[model samples]
Target: MTTISNTERGAAKVMNRTDLTQRLVARLHKDEAVVGGIGHTNWDLWASGQRPQNFYMLGSMGLAAPIALGVAVAQPDRMVFALEGDGSLLMQVGALATIATVEPANLCVIVWDNEAFHITGGQKSLTATGADIVAMARGAGLTNSTWAADEAHFESLVDEALGGTTGPRLIAARIDMTKPAGTTDRDPVKIRLNFMSGIAPPDKEG
Candidate 1:
């Protein structure tokens, strides 16, 4: 078992909050898709906005992957991106196995590995274990796994992952756990509405 402290990791994927959100939104800008997020504030920012797409999350930290698995299995045709933090992913890794078996090609696990739980006071996280994130996905029977910390690489991986045959794909986007910049917990009503929209019949948008 080996680990690399944030200090040792050096450098991080730096992008303005809005820019990051926009970039990710572009990737996941599809209706009938269920995107699972892990962080409260970050997820809230993506949710509270006019996403127009479907997104749900486990705001309490960890559990994003499992939720993503559920959505992907339920909606195998549409894509499901699990935008999660390294700390959150560490908390509930067993979901990886469930995802592996479900084999939903529409599911993509994008881990914003910042080495810490940004919402919880930016404390260190298990990602420091420097555990090969890509290997972890492979161990869980996921293909199309890679890691990126820069804009160019991330863009490429996103395209490739989405273009692939699907199933479970993982992208460990290396970033820093900076101060939280997002909204408060979401309204349960809106959450349910978004989910309903994901699976609702076409004539039921009202």
Candidate 2:
């Protein structure tokens, strides 16, 4: 497994979260399922576009990747993406090991590392003190983990992940602490039903 050094990560272009979220959403031509982590992660997803396949995590801190893993496992033909924040991902880093163990070919986890818990009062996260998420992910056996170098590089990684058949890939981006463009509607029931309906196979007439 190749290690991505801190110097390489420091060279990555710091980008705005909302812009990247929109970019990712725009690239989804298929009915790909996106599980957005709590706080601004989900807010940006909601702002990108109200896709029925987008599931927002209203209260959870670190369940986005796990939920996406379940979705990928259940629907092997569908691609799944998990958008998680640095702080939130650290809350359940174990999920990375589990995801690696399962090796869901269609699953991709994108970490927006802004170095702070922006939504929860902007407290500096461990990432600010030198915790390398991509390195940790690789250590957990996700050899495909990498830190996106810039906007174009991020897009290229996403495209590659979407096109590849071997995955359980992890992409970490150094992001700016910009506020989300909008807030997700706080209706868990509706969100759940919408996501289910969105990803469900079409009904066949007898």
Candidate 3:
């Protein structure tokens, strides 16, 4: 895989988070796992569709990627996607480096960079000023990191990642600070059990 440089682009495409989430959900046919971050990220994922393969985080600043990493490592045959917000990702940026070090081939990280902690108070984040998440991921040794230029480009990246490519890819997108349309059901135990059953091998699933 090749590293995508921020300097090589004009500006990242600004897209609605829910639209992207819906597009992603529509394309999930291989039982690929999705780990949604706290707040809007997970809210939109839950809204997109309550698939058993989707894990929604309720309360956490930046555990999405870490949890997805564990799932990817544990199920090497399954593709895992982690959806995170720019602010939350900034809170635990070190996870990117750890993900790079482990290098799970089926892992894909998607960062929604609205440039603010929208859930909290709409405070500006470093990305709003000058931080480039794709660049940061690349620096952390995730060479397959790239900024989606537009919705079409984002779809292309998603297709490539889910096509069984050997990658621990990171795809960052510029999103708007709109409220998500739905809420994740608040049942942690049920979520865990359903996800476990969804990902288990056919024969292993009782």
Best candidate, TM-score-wise? Answer: 2
Each prediction's whole-model lDDT (CA):
0.62, 0.91, 0.89
TM-score of 1: 0.79
lDDT of 2: 0.91
Reference-based lDDT, residue 197, model 3:
88
TM-score per prediction, in order, is: 0.79, 0.94, 0.94
Model 1 residue 17 CA deviation in Å: 6.6
Which prediction has more favorable TM-score, 2 or 3? 2
C-alpha-based local distance difference test score of model 3:
0.89
Best by lDDT: 2
Candidate 2 backbone overlaps, count: 0
Flag regions of model 1 displaced more than 4 Å.
1-18, 32-34, 44-48, 58-60, 198-206
| Range of the 10 consecutive residues with the lowest summed lDDT in candidate 1 | 1-10
Looking at model 3, residue 38 earns an lDDT score of: 94
Question: Model 1 residue 115 lDDT?
Answer: 69
TM-score order of candidates, top first: 2, 3, 1
Encode model 2's per-residue lDDT on 10-49: one tens digit a residue: 7888999999998898899998999999999999999999
lDDT of 1: 0.62
